[model samples]
Target: MSNESSPLQSSLLVSERMAFKLHRQGMIMETIGKNNAVCNEYPSPILPKERWRYQMVNMYPDSGQCHPFGRR
Candidate 1:
């Protein structure tokens, strides 16, 4: 049999990419926050279309403004 993985079985799924992007952003924010002191509470891996996370709860200003998660 041929060796191949289905779309669902792929490691780099859409959700995985989304999470990775979020994590990367968070790490950047944490670094900037430490430097500028404007950022507190490193943002957790964010999800798409999550209005609740839009709030600055323990997060820096305008965090994840690039996309509100649900945006295409």
Candidate 2:
């Protein structure tokens, strides 16, 4: 594996750092879910706001929905 960050990876890391700094300064940031149009353009295995998927799954175990955005 090459120990180098791709342009996209670098951008993500920079954004994550900036978000962390903002969070420490008491600025709240909301993650827009993967279903958003922008995310589709960049399609990745990792979903944006992935934590919400886990929370939803836990809350609706019997919902019978396999997707984070609910049934198609």
Candidate 3:
């Protein structure tokens, strides 16, 4: 509300109504970022939660059987 404030200073000042809204929105976005950050650290797993188990073993078909050169 200061007449003395330059255009840039006035533009950046948060109004009373906008202050609360902006602060709340910023906090929500930060929380969402943190919650999903861990998943981004690793490559996606082949198995979904419903099929994967703590002690489960993954069995692969013979790779060399299909290769034209055969197993090396």
Q: Give the alpha carbon lDDT tens digit for every residue of 1-72 in model 1.
A: 124255432422454465667776775233237567575676655433344222224546665553333332
Q: Write the candidate numbers in order of decreasing lDDT.
A: 1, 2, 3
Give the clash count for model 1.
3
What would the TM-scores of all predictions be? Answer: 0.27, 0.35, 0.27
- lDDT at 29 for candidate 3? 27
Summarize candidate 3's per-residue lDDT along 1-72 as a digit string, tens digits. 476366433433333224345444553122223476553333222222232212212546544432111111
lDDT of 3 at 27: 32
Best by TM-score: 2
Over the stretch 1-72, how does candidate 2's per-residue lDDT look in tens digits? Answer: 144357534544555555455546655544456667543232233433434331133443566543332211
Point out where model 1 deviates above 4 Å. Answer: 1-4, 27-41, 44-72
